[model samples]
Target: MAEEGQVIACHDLRVWHGQIRKGYESNKLIVVYLTAPWCVPCKFMAPVVDELAKKFTNVMFLKVDVDVKQLKYVPIDFGVDCGVESMPTFVFLKNDVVLDKLVGADKVKLEQLTERHATIVVYFTASWYGPCKFMAPVVDELAKKFTNVVFVKVDVDELKSKAVDFGVDSMPTFIFLKGGDVVVKLVGADDKVKLERLTETHATL
Candidate 1:
């Protein structure tokens, strides 16, 4: 809990599986840290996962305690199949599939896997527009809010061709792109709630 970024600890297996299902629908990468309250390596690795949560904003950071009450629900598909006998087992999942897994608290390989993962969010903007100026900080906060979405800024003046390609005629247009395609587009930044909800929608991959 001392860590920063959007890290959620679901002690309940049912709820955690729901979050995993959501990740599947969005096609975002799910990084699960299997830990226990008494495991020494799990304690040491907490800070590493926390830092990665901040570093890879395009990946969802989920912490699951193996010693939790819902042991029956925990080992069904992921844990049992992956042979998670050791503490601090790190699992990387994509498209409801287990892409890779690591045993023990090795942060090096985890970083490598994240660098080759999914999901990218790009923000298109122009430097001069008053609305864009007002929305800059708001969008940055949104980027921080969603760990699975990458928020990118594109100055229309600097990259006019890219702007034209995205059909961005206005000053401030928010485009949510995934798999190299536009999934959602919002024309204005007047409403912060709408901006946040829109980002939350596609933050998963």
Candidate 2:
């Protein structure tokens, strides 16, 4: 419904920049909701993000319809390397660099995660792995409790190239990254208590 570069009114305006200079010069804190039209979760999270934009005046909210030709400039203009396997990929940018990213519509958790600088927990797994299924619930629960940490899951089967780049040799591999560097890695389904302790130990350092 919203056209490229057209500022739509909800709670904040969605800026589709024609050039990187325009996008970068406007603000320091930019939240871009890269979405598609048919995505149900995107439709649901749109309003929630708008509400958050209203609350956080320091940040600017923008919507990029991935379906549009104009939106293709994202990867080239911004140096974003990730593929859009799913819709409603929320990317938090600070000074043109990706600070945080959320793949799905976990609105409450996403808001909390983006509120501060925190460690990122990335779970790399495949759907076929039984251990991944076992780990999913645990990861979900941990994400809910750890508001300061950003939790992400990468389906290795779907994103094979990414998995290879990350050196994921097994299923349900959890990588804890701080400041874009890998600090710790836990292979397979791990105890929730131990995971929490690992996060705690990292957070204090």
Candidate 2, residue 137: how far the Cα is off, in Å: 0.6
Highest-scoring model, lDDT:
1
lDDT of 2 at 160: 88
**How well is each residue in 1-205 modelled by candidate 2, as lDDT tens digits?**
4432232322222235432344466433556777777888888988887776554433456777766665566644544543545567777775567777777889887677545534677889888888889888888877666544556789987888978888889888889976567889888776767887887676444
In the range 5-114, model 1's lDDT, one tens digit per residue, is: 56668778677978778777756688888787888878888988888788665677888877676754564456544234477787788877788878877788777766
Candidate 1 C-alpha RMSD relative to the actual structure: 7.0
Model 1 whole-model lDDT (C-alpha atoms): 0.73
lDDT of 2 at 77: 53
lDDT, model 2, position 64: 72
Candidate 1 Cα errors over 4 Å, as ranges: 1-4, 79-85, 120-205
TM-score of 1: 0.57
**Alpha-carbon shift of residue 114 in model 2 (angstroms):** 8.2
Name the regions of candidate 2 deviating beyond 4 angstroms: 1-117
